[model samples]
Target: MKSLSIQEINTILNGELVGDTSQMIDGLEQLKNAQPNQMTFIGSIKYERLWDSSKASAAIVNENIRIEPGEGRAFIKVKNADLAMAKLLEEFDPGPPQFDIDIHPTAVIHETAKIGKGVKVGANSYVGKNVVLADGVVLYPNVSIFDDTTVGPQTVIWSGTVIRERTEIGAQCIFHTNVSIGADGFGYRPSDDGRGLVKIPQIGNVIIGNLVEIGSNSCVDRGKFSSTIIGDGCKIDNLVQIGHNSVMGRFCIMAGHSGLAGSVTLGDGVMIGGSASIKDHTVIESGAVVGAGSGVMNDVAAGKTVLGYPACDSREMLKQWVALRRLAKN
Candidate 1:
């Protein structure tokens, strides 16, 4: 583990220091689990009570907090303790190991494909006709990029990920293992004879904006007509499904196993919890939150938090639950 002086940590966090400045902090830990040589933080007032018993030698705290005089513990006071802690953890992180091979010998690149400077294609990867990989893009083993696809600079597509035709991924994006982008949307119509389902062709592509991170095994389907869009800084958790023609606004978060059906529109900063499902053609306005295991069947206003099946306002759901319990007792 890397160690830093208390003074150095204060400088890194741009925080005001109180108490001892010469202590060595070797690692970061939670208040409940901190060792004497480790650093910890109190991000909320709820955790302030933990400070007295915490064994950490140094702590990061908000500037507004008042500390008793003559305490032996060291502190770095910042504007936001949570953000400061995030920066500290980032500073301590040792990033992924670099590979020696820029373009592995086993990788196949079509002659028409444009590979930019500093791009790395790992073993058994395939880049197809007219594909464009911008500078600093990295494709790990067994990855496939189909015809006419474009990936922006500094993006990393991990092993077993596939980017289908006409898909466009933006800069600094990370697609984790087994991700599938621009797959055909699930669309069907009855046959002329009314005997079986006929597949409706998915002719549109997917557009992903910059700084997006898609988790492992997630799938984003292509649109039936217009493009399916994922806006800037959206974070999609593992096993999530984004259906055809859907548009997600900037900084939206979709937790694990959450799904959006075809033509759904999610406004900026919408949060979808685990196992939440939005019906087709639904609109969720900006800053709305769908609770875990929710089934959202209609439009949700901006800044609202909805919960339960056929989700309603959270307070209403709680009241309903209370009424149901009372009736059950009778």
Candidate 2:
């Protein structure tokens, strides 16, 4: 077991220690489920009440919380318990999945493809003609990289992922399992004589910047003419759908199941909560926050927070909700 003593943990967190300094904590868990050999954190006031019944002999707590450790337990007091927990999790992370081969025998590499040093291509993966795989790039089992695509150094693409032609992926990006990049945009036009629908030929690619992380099963569609751009440090969550020609600025975060319709533009630091849907061609400015379950239909100003259907300003939505509740009771 990989264990850390109370004294060792306090040094790493630079926290003030309270009570016993000798307990060995082998794991970290939630308050409701912690074992005696594990540590837990009470990051929010909502969880503080549950701490009394927890079996943990050690805990990390906020400095503002003034409770002493009971009995033989220990507590490490820090500025923020949640932030401390994140650091601890990084310490315990075992690193990415490891495969033994540099390039598996079953992987198909085209004659014209250029693979860099230290690249690891797993079983049944396909690298098509004119593709470039940079140094330290990892393609897990069953990944498909189409012709003319270029992946930068240290990018890790998980199993079952697909990269379409002409796509450019920057350094240190992570594409989780089953992600689809540069697929055709959803575009259709009415045919002549109104007989049937005609497909719009999507000829564009996707450009992803460095340090981007896309969660499992998400899809980023190709543009109609140009590129669908995702800026550096963007984090897109599981099952998210980013439509054609959409441009996301640096450090933008989209939670699970959130979607951006065709050509949507998001400025730096925009936060999209889970299940929020932004309409086509809408622009969200920097630092704006869209609450969960909202359906946004228009532009959102910088640093503004929006909520509710046809998403309005958060303050306006609150007033409307209050008025509707009052009218309902009458």
Candidate 3:
């Protein structure tokens, strides 16, 4: 518990001190659990119930909120107390600073690999031959970048993520933990003997544009023949599956558990709800919304909202639901 006077804390957070400047605060804690040497913030009205029982030495509170100041307890009022507290917390509990030109000895980098200035490769990471990692890229521990892959500058890949052969990821992209990019697509062929199924070869790569964010545990399969592309500024949620050869346009939002089959094309600003599934070869236009648990089997026009299994217009689906309810009432 590092202690700082109220005046020092105010300086750190760039906030005004309205109470005792000499009061000491050891650390930050929640309203209910804050001790005599700790400070807490009233960020939400839902936490107002904790005010009466709080035992903290001081509290950072909004300027508009009124609270009775108890004996020996200080109240620091600020214009935006939540943000002030956030700044204070950041000052005290800062994350690890960005690494500059540091590569662990355990990391394997091919002699021919092109690593730009100030790149940081963590322990047990592998950079393949002819791979290009641009300036300011940070590869977390255990990351794998296969041969001929190129990652643009300032990309941060979390631990245990895999970037398979020839995949191209752009600048400022974030790959969360356990993400698998460019894995083989699910394809099968009929056996020559007509007795069983055989796996088809996946030869194409995945290309992710700048500023795209892929969540943890998500998988983007490699194309069976051509490239699978995800455009810039797309936000994909956790546990989503983007099948091989799919092309997602800029700023698309795909929620958790959503699945897009092979060869699907989504235009700019498409939004998909949780657990929705889009069939292969389907095209969804810009500004479209696919509702939760919906199954999209055909093309969706621009600026429309669809819902239900085998998705239809949201208004139609709601009408059908209301009719069903009326029948049940009768």
Candidate number with greatest TM-score: 2
Worst 10 residues of 3 by lDDT: 14-23
Global lDDT of each candidate:
0.94, 0.94, 0.90
> RMSD of each candidate?
2.2, 1.2, 4.8
Tens digit per residue, CA lDDT, model 1, 1-330: 789998899889999888884558889999889988899997777777788888888889987777631366688888999999999999899887577889999999999999999999999999999999999999988999999999999999999999999999999999999999999999999999999999999999999999999999999999999899999999999999999999999999999999999999999999999999999999999999999999999999999999999899999999999999999999
Better of 1 and 2 by TM-score: 2
lDDT of 3 by residue, 115-151 (tens): 9998999889999989999999999889999999999
TM-score of each: 0.92, 0.97, 0.76
Candidate 2 regions with alpha-carbon error over 4 angstroms? none
Per-residue lDDT tens digits of candidate 2, residues 1-330? 578888988889999888884568888998899999899997766667777898999889998775677889988888999999999887777788788879999999999999999999999999999999999999999999999999999999999999999999999999999999999999999999899999999999999999999999999999999999999999999999999999999999999999999999999999999999999999999999999999999999999999999899999999999999999999
Candidate 1 clashing pairs?
A: none
